[model samples]
Target chain A: LNVNINRKRKWDIGKLIYMENVSAEDCIKRWRNEDVDDEEGGDSDSDDSNEEDFFKKKDENSSKESNPKQTIDLEQFVPYFDTFEKLAAKWSSVDLIKNRFIRSAVERK
Target chain B: MSNSKSPLRIFEGHQNFRLRIVLATLSGIPIKLEKIRSNDLNPGLKDYEVSFLRLIETVTNGSTIEISYTGTTLIYRPGIIYGGSYTHQCPNSKPVGYFIEPMLYLAPFSKKKFSLLFKGITASHKDAGIDVLKWGMLPVLEKFGVRECALHTLKRGSPPLGGGEVHLVVDSLIAQPITMHELETPIISSIRGVAYSTRVSPSLVNRMIDGAQKVLKDVGCTVNITADVWRGENSGKSPGWGITLLAEMKKNWCLFSECIGDAGDVPEDIGAKAAYHLLEEISRSTAIGRGQLPLAIVFMVIGKEDIGRLRINKNQIDENFIHLLRDIKKIFGTEVYLKPVNDPESDDFIATVKGVGFTNANKKIA
Candidate 1:
């Protein structure tokens, strides 16, 4: 199927990685499973689809990203409130660290 | 050197805290504590998007795990961007601005005993990285039984090798199913102790060649060596061959030792072109055009992608890549075969040609 992908395929390795391996994500969620919002609770009826969408390939030479709040875009695409709640926390900590450093550096010392 | 003979837990501080799981035993495995304490990083690099892991761990008989950053760099860095800046002065003198991303790690020892298995890493040693490995990981591993230190290269070009162009170098090893011992000795010896530099020089290449041989000899192993040089960087005049030479290097190494000949004071780009055209002949070979073989070198690539970095016109990547492969095959002729494949971790072009390795002004190993 003459795949006309503009994303350079020769050097892009996203496919070689195990996108479905739940260790890294599970590790984070296993810890952040506490902050669940019952109001927005949703069963992961489409985890397979979510996994597929989350792993959709992107452009190669891309250089920009969406805002921080929009960080949940990948998660937003996920129907599992459970997975989202935890991953959000795990990722938030990372953001917290980066944000703290950037803010502090931009401010005083 | 044996000590307490128990499991060890180690950690290092980078932009992020990377936890390493080590299994040291006939059965002893490292159990992740509910809490892992790590110091956070503040000093940072601009244009940085993703966080890199600085992992350290100790496994007693359970299984020894080694996070070798040095190997990661050696395999990948040599094929990355050509112009690597190295300031001669203080603080700025350390101007290397590239990092490697890791995928998975494994220690294949059946019965772990005093073993330091560095699964993923760059060959170049960062001051901070070494400090963590040596101080934090070493002592911890020693407690369990990490006697010999061994590491493997996971993803190439992610960390890059000594920076250069005139001598664009990459490697390909087509072998039948080899045992761990056979692979380990050669792999370990190939890059036991190495260094990096942006400028490509014959002296440096010779040194690496010599070092490789010595390491292999010391490890008591017999192996063959083939180097395909591609000199197509910033070279403007020889654009056609410059790019072609790179594709060629994926399956071949330069034959000339002095490929970076007198630039004749030509423009850097022109010199670059000349260098690429002449790379294969650097250490000139009388049999320039010889019989070809059918072989394909496939590499998976990955990298940080923002919103609109790439535009794959067609649906699948393999489709687009096949076209490039056809072009390469046509250039190299019918006898020779070439294909390009994408990996999941890196986002660089990997040219796969039968029975050959690929190289360019900058390095990329897919």
Candidate 2:
């Protein structure tokens, strides 16, 4: 049964949507459990601990963190765009954020 | 049959032009790309892309490239792979790695011994820096039966004011097709790195190394990293320090990740982020991580076997990768298959392909 579901999931290619508002620190913390937000508390509006708990709960529910909003880590843009004006213009700005949007209302496997 | 013989088609505005061009050249298939950013202002190919095409021409003989006056359309006809000593002044706007990555793919297959002296930014956050390639790509080449390949960073160049230089020498050998049926579980034997500082205080390198090593140790990885501090002429026009970490597995496979210390970016964060990437790769059961998948796929597409397989992440197979896979199948008739696994131990998927069994153009008829 799991294999059948796995086969179905493999065919499901989610369109990559680059989320902009999410900062690099937020991504690293969420991905690696860095817990930097607890220390800095830079964005006073959002409670860091509550957000972490939310992520952990969601992650447990689904093995893969299937967040609709994906952040193309700023680091990937390098080497390729360092000096190329076109690549820099294409990927450098917030275009990644503009590129993809979540279409499916229901997260179908 | 006529349609199949036609040049492979590519639309405009795609970023992997270099990869596509190299693939076309290696496969000896003509390719035509049109509507290159047609709707955009200052559309067509960029200065760096043109420079990249010129470099591709230098490595090959009689390669034909045609571009529209507005630069919106272009056609490329590949030529023989004739590699020899070359000295190229890389466009100041891009790091040398942009040129180096493609050069690494084509060098071993050249008829003559490939020796190159590249002058430009040696290390940048944008491309795989010289440090990353030396540890990551060089070993991969060696694994594929490429011998006597040497990658050296002669000088360190930073961005904007890049004057870095690198000398690479690869033997003239026909690339023997390889079959890497299964990627062994990555047992990180050691974590090695270079904390390089150019036109900056040597202490910066130490601080970066300390920050990076702290994270590696915390993650239970061997902190076997080293530091390289350059002064005066060796350091380029700009002042910066960054770290490049190479996680060497028990097998020859290497996973490299790096970050640069930019304005407002703390050196410690740069070091820690690079370490985190290495930890992420080590944590994965896949043979290649996201960083090296594209490069590995390039080899798989060109191998002499009828079939090749490797374990990889499904998320790693992005749009550019999909484009490349399709192009390879069209140009070389290689069929690629992706199989997903539900194993609780590893989330990685299996990518298998039947190669076209392409041999070098220069191979003597026997």
Candidate 3:
């Protein structure tokens, strides 16, 4: 009788070759920094003016280093990143319970 | 005992309570939980949590659990998992899924074959339903070399007057460490589902299947959904209907989506919603579903000593996920690395971890 092996295969406990490449400390540090970034981003809306000023200074610094034409191009790219950051901030604060994708995935059993 | 040297891991709040217990049990590290819903008008452990603890005690050997008078503080020193045939009546406050979720973590590491008969609400809004476990979770376990497992839904029960029954049988991992290398999301081979209704109109099940098929037809895959209508005795005390959809992908991966009918919910709408949810999951193209990430992480951490890799969507990370990582580090001392997938357009991240190679000490060697 032909049977699907994938449906039948079960193995017992045995040691496999250990391969460790990533450092646990660095991973923890990265996760911590990401958390800090999330907290800051969530509160960024309160300091809107400061953020705008910072962006303006960044644009000015870029303009000083490059030609006038490239500066205009850089200026055009700045708002895209700004909007992306704002979107990220908004995304983080939105309750996952109310999110359509998450609710759909969770509501049923 | 190794438990003597390990300091009790301290935790606060009631978040991820079941997971904390599972980790403590698997790692053999004692834990102290305080301030569990302490500030609430009704403080302390919920009825469902107590029921879960009772079930844990029934399944394990020599476990010690201490709860404060007000139930605000809890100290748990886990015992050896001595899995055997048992029956547990779950609380009505939460569904049987709540209990079964944690049991999945502990059962495979048990000394004997685990056979548990759970009687309670099988489907609810609060937890993944029994169908999800049978179709979705069991397949994931299969990827980790756990094949001798099955979840049979003996009865259909909905909330308020839950009388459902489900039987779970899992054999302990005796020879090989759990290993899975599913990083790339495979194309879906087919779609299968079950639309079940209890103490309700049989027509509702058909409507739900129609709604799901209407949405899934455009995906160019075989969609087969069965309508399961239960009557007296088999149907629980309350009237309810729901749909569970499973997208079976190539390479033995399955993604599940479910929608339970609430008050004034249309069967068609529930079906469409579940189908849309499934489409969203397919689009994300992660190895594991967002809701299954925590369970997958736990399995990865406790797997073989070798490295395991899983692809998960970075956007799925939330407060609970972050806290789980922190708690794992505290209890198991295992940290997992997250590297962005090569595709710039996708939000997927590859999580890499070296397992602790946890084997069942209670299982006798032949």
Candidate 4:
């Protein structure tokens, strides 16, 4: 009466897992939650209330299991979009100045 | 002053040897390579690699290269990229593209403009052909705001006997590259190709074009492929035929794929194979083609201090790309962050990185 317990692994766990189709805000929230989980796991040994700890752990596990998708908020990690906007503004201003100069030169000519 | 910093030590075989040397040169860092193919029976650098080293020495100034007796150990102290008019006769073992690829990286940062003449096999199975560099890589450079460049294939040379010649010219960048933030994969506007034959029957070029068009007709895009038959002196020492296809996308982005005819291969097979390769590249739906990712990434890392963004397919993140990322981080101390694009249908990742602001120290300040 031996039951086969080994499950076939579909993909390599060591390989990088890219979050699929997720927004920036949700990605930040997920990262925050992961940080909180890590902190809690590190201090779990100091907690004396076993029953309460079990229920808290169970809720956290259930919530994580419910949401399988993850996202990355690039703005939070780096100022990429902000930099692009700034550059665009600078470029427009430069173009405006150049255009005015060209118009003046043409009129003088 | 560079000698004050300790030389970077690298081990193992000659994988990414050209890239390592290029990075060292650009960064002005000395590098010592150990155990290059030490375990193998030959246990030394290949003839082509030594030829490439010689080419590097010919192009640069004040560079010191020391190779050990066994050619397994090498110490290279990089100097200023003093690019100017020069001629190099490449060994027949590898095509001219092998040398040209690294030159493309070094050229824009050089003190003087590059007008290089290379004599070797123009088209081969080992590396990108001269046509690919012309139609594929040169246009990609334009995206980085580098426009004054041209590659002219003077003669069509295949492998083995190898009597081909190409002239390459590139203007040095006056300032740092503009930030590249193209994240969207544009729609392909048209497909254009060249089916070239050297010392072969002129009809073979037409057969190759027909074979390519047969595969490309169903794509619903304007397909125009021309035949280029070289004869007499223009045809190289070896007799060969090949096809290079380019898929022109919107916003002037291009994807290139090429296949060369081997000794026993037919022209039709070569053309069809090149077409299929292009189709595969198109299907990847990346802003930069998979083969051009490393080059694009290197350019992005050395761009202006502002962040540059690019869209890359997840499938393109192979082992070599990872190695490139690690090497870039080690040398330039810049890292690229990848964020998944919010599209369920596509596996695209938007890679963003703050450039290191690496300007040419050799350039004179006005």
Candidate 5:
């Protein structure tokens, strides 16, 4: 029975091998899922995401506290889930588009 | 059968164990403590450690709280060495032990800020779920004396998944002790009686053989050396071993160390220098201490590109290592041994050098 197997598994000290022995995909998947956990779960203050948020929060908080008048979106610097590689590539291309508008008559492409 | 004064029944109730004072605060979960032997075979702590443990007395500070957490929070450090199972499992799984003093100030929100924002959750909710973790961190704090929390799994629910964390605090005292038992022991494979390890990289394997050759040569014992890497599909840089390795010799002991880095083609001289540093660090650790210093030193050097690019005019990498081994014999005493690794491809080598030293010296003159 599954119950019996669960008990056997529970008592087995060797189950810890699974901890040190996760698959690469499993490890990465687990790592990536941290973001999703932070989104759905509180108590997260998830380190994976809050780095930028800390700076933005500090800036906005200071602004609001000091000026007594600024509306800080706080989200200005915190972008959605794009990897560092993905964001870097996308930003370069978007900046290129802005640069290309210098003269529509001639296109480098 | 003697008189009433016979021996007075010599029952001085001194429980030799420095109060098993289980400091459990915050998480009201009740855990029964029949007895706790540190999972490792440490007979007892050294004087300094015991003296430091005396501080726990001041922290436990005559509190009547049945269980008082020595600190505000807990922390865990997931490094290349400690790996995963080295972690203490507190909850979610049928728990075994509890963490004692967790410095709590660098709260969850503070630990892995990057991972948190990725979830795009409100700070309040995020703070509630993973930020204020009460368990899984006490030992890390008591061990390393640092502020960083990586959460693996902390909640109580279905699909209960969690990660570990680390962070810094403005001012905190809960020291994170880096448990040494994790690395000092050799991992044995359940499948075989002989010690089995998977991540003994090719170069490291060669170095181990080299180091072993010297000691074996000196002792007049012929030994077999094997080599391989962890092919576990999930395996990358860190490979987990199944058993702890202790040499089966009578009077000799061994110390093994491996360094992995972007050491771009370090020369033989540099290798010897790195060897010196690694040896110094291993000798300094409270775990291996002086008792095990004399017999053997095994270094497992790991790197793909670094080992191949290394070159010395006098001899090949193996020969250079042998020279270093011979040098070790010249210095302290002529009994040190080695297992120098040679990685032809990518210039990586792992050497498990071993030696015999006179551990009876009384002073710290050196």
Candidate 6:
């Protein structure tokens, strides 16, 4: 298959970033469940006739993205939203701030 | 260092806030940015931008970041940069190059020799590619006496399905600021590129090369472009193909451009587009090429307190370049002056600035 996709494949990371009230885990879980449902559907409908339907669902899910919104119109394409959403969900705020430390004992120059 | 005087006050909503943050960290200056995209329909900071700020905070100690409830308005007080082994999961919204681009400026002056592993998109049509750093940035670092620097790609991830990995190891050193006033007239001695295709027909690489060479040949340039092909496991999680061209000049300066293969984009057109971009760069007599303005400025700011000069094409002088120059002046107290260079062949201009005499702020690692 000559898959010429214009859209780069990640999900909307901006929507899932760490916020004060919003839990990163919750965001990840919600997206991951959605992705799980997608995969199950893809597996069950393993026929050439269902390929069109598979792609149609992809376009609908990813059409409302903001980033890379208008750089070059790739036109109706499905990106790897599930992978990115899963990764973002897995990344913890603790992971981002793990090695953060302040050094004491600096001589005045 | 007078503590009595007030720090610089800057208004917000600028896209290049990372540049300001990096400079402030190096200069040890506190900056307060207000109204950060507050007026816009989608107000406040975006995910990748905030992630960049967090990365800066992780790399330094005693640094402070204060953000308002709405994600608009910020106060950043910088501390000494303590560079060491660190890994970051770059947000999928932007490519890894987005993070690595700033590291090119901060890594050499770090407290400890640093090794950074960045995971995410490696290449996108919208962001700088790993190849740009390999061919364009690494050589510029070497010119300033930065030793043992390595930028290597472990995997290739294209935008949207990014899972690419890259390892960059840089040695800590007090920069030897240079005086790059004399530019060896640029002559394209050779053309080299990587035509990368992932999960696609291996023959796509050849078609791209053939199409690109045809364009270069018609222009009467007879240099053969060497091509490297990455396939299967090496090519990241997604399927894509594109070409990145680096034209080596007789002088240390190099000009580079890239074009990724799009859906329905002809392999020949991808190759020809990259070749034409290179030809356009060749026509301009500037020492610094497009997409390298910010880098050229960083080199000048960090070099020994001598004057560094660069010539950029007139059309390339956009608002971002102008604002970056202004922010450099604000943060480092250095001035970047512009003058029109008289070139009949092209509308090129010159910019010159003296270094702030910046040195590593962290205690030497013993």
Which candidate has the highest DockQ of all? 2
Docking class of 6: incorrect
RMSD of 5: 28.0
User: Positional deviation of B164 in candidate 2, in angstroms?
Assistant: 0.5
lDDT at position A16, candidate 2: 12
Candidate 2 vs. true structure, TM-score: 0.77
Docking class of 5: incorrect
lDDT of 1 by residue, B163-192 (tens): 211111012111111111000000111112
Interface RMSD of each: 24.0, 16.1, 17.4, 19.9, 29.5, 23.8
User: Which portions of model 2 miss their true places by more than 4 Å?
Assistant: A1-109, B1-8, B341-344
Which digits, one per residue and each the tens of the lDDT, describe model 2 over residues B74-161? 8888888888888988888778887888887888777788888899887675677888778778777776667678887888988878
The estimated TM-scores of all candidates read 0.19, 0.77, 0.77, 0.77, 0.19, 0.72
Write model 4 residue lDDT over B250-308, tens digit each, in one string. 78888888887877877776777677667656655476786677778888998879999
Residue B247 error for model 2, in Å? 0.9
Indicate whether candidate 2 or candidate 3 has the larger lDDT.
Answer: 3
DockQ of each: 0.01, 0.05, 0.03, 0.02, 0.01, 0.01
* Candidates' chain A TM-scores: 0.19, 0.21, 0.21, 0.20, 0.20, 0.20
Error of 5 at A35 (Å): 54
Clashing pairs in 2: A78-B126, A78-B127, A79-B126, A79-B127, A80-B126, A83-B93, A83-B94
Question: How many steric clashes between backbone atoms does each model show?
Answer: 103, 7, 9, 0, 105, 10
TM-score of chain B taken alone, candidate 6: 0.91
lDDT tens digits by residue: candidate 6, B27-117? 7778878777677788888898888988888777778888889888888887777788889899988888888888888887777887999
Model 3: number of clashes?
9
Overall lDDT per candidate, in order of appearance: 0.21, 0.65, 0.71, 0.71, 0.23, 0.64
Clashes of 4: 0
**Reference-based lDDT, residue A99, model 1:** 17
- Which parts of model 6 are misplaced by more than 4 Å? A1-109, B1-6, B219-222, B341-347, B363-366
- Model 1 agreement with the true structure over A1-109: per-residue lDDT tens digits: 1132222122112232222222222212222332222333333223465544543433111112311111221101001112323433333322222211112222344
What TM-score does the first chain of candidate 6 have? 0.20
